[model samples]
Target chain A: MKKINFYILLFVALLSVLGAGCINEQTEDVASNGESGENEVTGTETQIDTIYQFSVIDALLEGVYDGEITCGELKENGDFGLGTFDNLDGEMLELDGVIYQVKADGNVYEVQDTETSPFAAVTFFETDIQDSIKTEMNSQELAAFIEDMLPSQNLMYAVKVTGNFSYMKTRSVAAQEKPYPRLVDVTKDQSVFEFNDTEGTIVGYWMPEFVNGINVPGYHLHFITTDRTAGGHILDYTISSGTIEIDSCDSFYLELPENENYQSTGLSADNEADLEEAEN
Target chain B: MKKINFYILLFVALLSVLGAGCINEQTEDVASNGESGENEVTGTETQIDTIYQFSVIDALLEGVYDGEITCGELKENGDFGLGTFDNLDGEMLELDGVIYQVKADGNVYEVQDTETSPFAAVTFFETDIQDSIKTEMNSQELAAFIEDMLPSQNLMYAVKVTGNFSYMKTRSVAAQEKPYPRLVDVTKDQSVFEFNDTEGTIVGYWMPEFVNGINVPGYHLHFITTDRTAGGHILDYTISSGTIEIDSCDSFYLELPENENYQSTGLSADNEADLEEAEN
Candidate 1:
């Protein structure tokens, strides 16, 4: 009986040590993951949904036009997007996993993998809603119509309109040297191009008012023709008929530049008025 | 010689197996942590800075006053902050790791640990800048002064002011029942209080315009006396003397509720005007 009791006590001590070790391991795992341990025990993988952004509109407004990411790196994040190349070289349009630069000379050049962008918004195109419009409408009317069609005003939307346009007016800014002026100043000298009965796709995003400083608050579209010959930032377009595709983006991930220019730039001035002036 | 060669080959094979095992272990560690192997090699621990928010202000404005998190859970995130209790019970003041409820009954109660908040912003208090204010100034002047004192407009700031107030005016919303009206409507019946020669601390945050819909655009402050007696959402104050502390926050993390009320709410309306009307 004495031997049995002693053995039982020894077993209990060993069990307690093992239990404490398990608890310690569990605690460390929870602390490292910053989450409860239930998921770990079940081996559940947490899905992180994110909408990747290259740069902010505020930095662009502050005249930090230097590109920090190459076109090759940008393609890894999204196949469809819009922005300008380094030093405002041209209006950038990405569609079908290909990037095109519409220069001020009214010509579309396939962007080289080595090329870079100052500011851009891109995403793997996935449509949640699709509709066709047969009525003729201009840019402003189409913007209003899209706003009306949106399921929720609080969420951001990626927009794609593809079809033939009766009239398309677009503009592209010339590349600038160092000491770039504010976007509003550079945009004043933009070269405009007018195309008649053009077949192309319009790619852009509709941002909410809350993200105004971070991104354009309304429709920001860029046009790229089917023949890959001519395109630019869409200023005004009369769509004869088109199919509209909308993707409601619930996740947002903004990547800020790590360059010295972005670090030293002064972004305090309220750029709302300036942004509106430049965008229009 | 033949035996030596066999032994040498066996040793090399063993070393290769060990090296491959180490590599496999390292790969698994990196995959589990969801970080690159390069960061692991540098032995640098990434500090994830987050601003744990309660429910959104839009839901509050829309009259969704249900509390999703308890003060105890909130205390786990930060010790300094301000907000309102469930059903707009009263003003919530969190200071020095304790939460106080200043209700319409004109009494301050140390809130029970189970008490919850509908909306609040809190951070572990860490001051980056400290200064004294000698000049007497009203609420607007103090706001401007603090704005001028901020090191950067792009970053968020946690502010704390402690001293004597020549005059302070505050308001607290009464607890509401179900079928709650909009915040603008509830503000019409708020209980306002005025104090003279009060000594206390003011706590709040200065948010950027980019977070307009996510949070209050500017300052959102609440006051609590040093004696743990009286406080509410600060409407106006005439500061006689005070010491100000500001913490510049470079990282922001927002946590949204997963409740049915939040999931189905209509938040697209331009609530800026309504927010301004209700806040002032």
Candidate 2:
């Protein structure tokens, strides 16, 4: 009888330990999830081939230059993208997981992860199609050539062109102060940079007409030299030879800025004419 | 010794059972979440004020009539909004978590969970503002009043107007056969319905200009009678007494359709004029 009682006590003790093990497993599982919540990744990772955009082109055109999303947050979403820094400072281009800022002085610098952007579009760069330029082509002809190669023009494409350019004309905006002028006005005073016989890469998006208000509708490319030193919003580039890769983005995630300026600004007015002038 | 031996076997059996229970818990967690991959919910339960749209309006305008999102899938996203069914069969409206289809026969039917949609927009309805229309107002007057009351036209809104209308004019298109006709052509021969002094709700989205290509730039609404027996896409309505509730949607999730028809469709064509003609 004494032996049976001792065995029974041992059995109860072992059962509790096993039950405790199960409880700890669940607790650890939940704790790990809670930790990830602090990061951009949730229980599931963000989907690939999706273009994540912060704010709208219309808002930026109207000079809503301060945004909430940090450069760090945007980098987590995509390794490639293009946009403008806070205060309409300069042209921002992300390539190969690095964010480069072309300041108003026409010099390129590494963008700090803590810096914020007013407008930007980014996607994981996965080349769905590739074309090599065997001959020379100007901006229009190159654009037309790239356009013809897309599987469908209805979808947005992240375009990357790497090669030699005989001429590259670019512009970067100066950081603005208070009482910000319209984007078109700022572009008028933008610092222009010209490059000849340069080896660089052009990265941007080929957006559809529907994105006219949300983003620039056509090719909005920015060039970065091989050394990652300098580039700006591409005005025109005469390519002697290049290789173009396009990533077809099927999904779009647009997060509107919650700033008071974004809410109070007049975004309904037809800004197409102004947008065309400013982007060029 | 025999009793001790018996106790050891029981303890081992019980321990393995508990271990299996924990293993099953983890397995079930992932299995349940994804077994229904067709109804995969995004990481955030979809933001309250975000407008979730499947496919683009230009695709529909160009006769991409079939889609892949089931009615059940859309319901998981939002309980309020509007859209059309696959094959352009009829107008679809969701209110109070129920999907109602206003068919070409001028009859409202509960949409099946299995029914797919080609184009639709939905949002979890949470009214940020409410206004009472005590006096009579025509369609144009009502629209203008709502426009003036909006804080900013930059954001989208899910509008719900429940009231008595002196005159209501609505239309619904029949499901097209193979080789679907352009939306403009379908609307030319659409079935029209008129009601005198009807009690119902006008449910739809008031999108910003930026959504011109992806969604209707302005108001796109559907009507369902109080009895849930009849209604269609709202053409015109004269409100005698009504209460308007608007939920401002700040984020947008656009999921492009992957159907062969959608892939083959030419979505880049400017269908703004045709959209205006068909919608009105």
Candidate 3:
């Protein structure tokens, strides 16, 4: 009878251990998640509508251009957007899950998954509003058109415009050497490209004014030709005819780099005038 | 022999079912988590040093006076901070996990978990820097002293000052009725209270200027006495002696309210001057 009692105790102990082991395995899966915003993206849900950005525009304006996020990592959070390559190499345009680099040499190159960006904004674009612009409209006019048609100016938007353009003016910065100068100084000697009757797409974001220091207050756009051959940061363009798709984003997840470059920069000072000059 | 084999098969199947059941129960606990920002707080590891805020200050300025988040839900994200109650009610302050409501009647009351807020910022307070102030200093001087000592103006800080005050002045707004007036208008006739030789603790945050529309640009504080009896939004104070503790927060998680009132408010417009008037 004592032997049977000992056997029963052993059986109960084994069952409890097995149950606890199964529970720990499940908890460990969740416990490994890094941060909340990060876990949300890497988790199964695949956050679609969030304006996920790596670093702030002020960091770039302050010339903190060393990339902290890889293209592969960024792509997981977004399938469409724009940014600049590591060391401010060139303008980056991401559309339909692929990243394109428009170098200052007026050549477009596909980026490696390991390549990184100093600053970028991207989202898994899903059109909330789709409309066609049959008439000719300059950059300002097109901006105003979309501005008026948006449900609310307060929300962030990922805008994609694909069409034939009468004229498209763009600029790209050369990869900077060590001791990078401020973006304002670099843009003073940026390479400019002008395309006549170019067929391409404009990928960009229209952020609210509250994001003045964090991101560009208005539209910050990049372009890629129909053949995926050429494009750069859009300076100005006259869209002869185009289809505009705007993805209204209500959530924004900003992950700031904690590098010395990002931390040491005097981000509080007014960069509006400098940002306006560099962006334009 | 066949009967014995059937029993053995049944026992194995039961064990597997029990294992799966345990695993599912653990996973469901995490699966019910609403959002990442929220999940991080409600999770086992309480997130520290995150400047967590619900709704934008611009919403309050625009008269979006309805509460969307319960005090209980907000406390999960923070143990110290300040905001107002539902219906644009009196000032609210939280310290050491307890929330206090300072009404326009010049009385402080303990708040229930079910109570809600439309706009508020909170953080789990952990001291990174602690110092004692022996010399008397006016509000401006005290603010400048703390401001100069901060590692970076770019980062948000939760500030707590506990000591003897030569003089303290605070204000609390009355709960608004339907068709709520703008916060600026409400402040114009706010109830003010003054105390001499007050022994209390000042709880607040000092956010960067970039948070202009989202939150107050500079110091936004509320006060509660040492006895935990009386307090309101800090307007002016002269500290004869105090202990200041600052918690520098590098991460800020903002969760905006999506109610019809929040959606309809024109948050894009300039609210700087109005904010200054209302806050002061």
Candidate 4:
């Protein structure tokens, strides 16, 4: 009887083992496939929309701490590195003194120096170079606009010049955003400029909040400002710099450009070409 | 030779079966432990936080939204039903228009009526209380101090809020730290206020940005607007009626009280105290 009972237990255990064994084998195969599935091939879902920031000088000098990292960090990771023109499925352009590689996917980064890094060999695309010059702005217009846009409350503004720049990994740092407002006299004498040493007249208009915000007054606006200051940065090729500050309570609506393509001045989107990327 | 070969194959197969069988037994033991581990007398490291939104009227009249499910969809499941005050761990406070059960652990959910559903049995923590009070221009003293503390350009700011009300969940949608400027205006209307007739004082404050942003306001400043209005919510009454629009922004400045205890002016820290117990 003892032997019979022992054999019954043994047989039951053996059958359970066999059943579990086969199930385990099948489950192991499923688990292995599921674990490695993530790395097999980059899923179409892996392709995500990402934005990068690039600093002109940082790319050329092969240095870190550029605008590219600042902008990229604002969105997600701050890992925008320099790229070469050769491997890019896009084009390249030279603005001011810096070289930029613009990718077909709308990614713009600093072009690496070919001589320094073997992998940095790049192709510069200069297929389209139009002399993007706008009609000049009269002295009355520039002066009137500057006089009108003075801030009432105490305010501070910043201009990002060529240098080492860094931004928080995200727009909010520990639940705080928006640039600081410092007490400044916007109407200060140094804030305004009439013209440089050039024979041609020059006028400067400053929007402290506009540039300090995310988007820079891109090239089109730059051209308008430069043209308004006729022969200033445009004719003499000198980077004209200036700002006007106000320290008192003043309510004035500065004249923003009504030009269709100008984004900074709050352009209208009714026009066909203007309808493409009009800023709200 | 054939008999010997058959014996060898059988022995190897038995060994393989034994090894797989042992592994399967061990795996089953581990899987079973998962449930026991959670309910163990000795607490496990596992902890989860969830947030829910309900109006003051809903909280007082019907009790907290009792609709809940244990394993799947709560809404689809049926009447998971109303919540009621189980017991009080510490102090009680008045907000909106009713008396709320304030737990020592800082959990401040509405005390419901039925005991059938989980929501009916559990206590809700007051993580945040929404109101409409203008903060920026209300007090010159507070406004100037906040303005002075604005961080410099490219520098990150760390602002926090801690007080009576919800702590587990915040208006934390999309992780943008800065509250929307328009929301501030929307909540600024005088019509949004209902003077607590008993105390004869108004309650509400301007809502700041929910999350961080490129150019956003700080969370502490929002606290100044929201938590300090009408000299604060009643220290002993439950929320009677609240008409405030809150997104995920409630999470803003949530972790603040965890690190530092703020001198919460409104309704006392009873709500905040109830909500933070599980976190510690």
For each prediction, how big is the interface RMSD? 17.6, 19.6, 18.2, 27.6
Best by TM-score: 2
Q: What digit string (tens of lDDT, one per residue) describes model 1 on residues A1-280?
A: 0011233334534664677858545433322331222221111011021245666788888788898778876665556678888988999987766788999989989878789777887765655567898999988888877776665555567888999899999999999888989889999999999999999889999866657667887788999887989889888999999999876565554555656666567774367889888887
For all predictions, the C-alpha RMSD in Å is 15.9, 15.5, 14.7, 25.5
TM-score of 3: 0.79
Backbone clashes in model 3, listed as residue pairs: none
**Candidate 4 lDDT for residue A203:** 17
Give each model a TM-score.
Answer: 0.66, 0.82, 0.79, 0.22
Per-residue lDDT of model 3, residues B59-144, tens digit only: 89989888989998787667778999899889999887678999999899988889989988887777788888999999999999
Question: Model 1 misses residue A10 by how many Å?
Answer: 59
**Candidate 4 lDDT for residue A110:** 50
> Which is superior by DockQ, 3 or 4?
3
DockQ class, candidate 4:
incorrect
Give the TM-score of chain B in candidate 2.
0.84
Q: Candidate 2 chain B: worst 10 consecutive residues by lDDT? A: B1-10
The C-alpha stretches of model 3 lying farther than 4 A from their native spots are: A1-46, B1-46
Error of 2 at B191 (Å): 1.3
Q: Give the Å shift of residue B143 in candidate 3.
A: 1.9
Cand. 4: chain B TM-score: 0.18
Q: Return the top candidate by DockQ.
A: 2
For residues B19-85, write the lDDT of model 4, one tens digit per residue: 5554334333322222122211110011001111111111111112222222111111111111222
What is the lDDT of every predicted structure here? 0.72, 0.79, 0.79, 0.21
Ten-residue region with minimum lDDT total, candidate 4 chain B = B252-261
Better of 2 and 4 by lDDT: 2
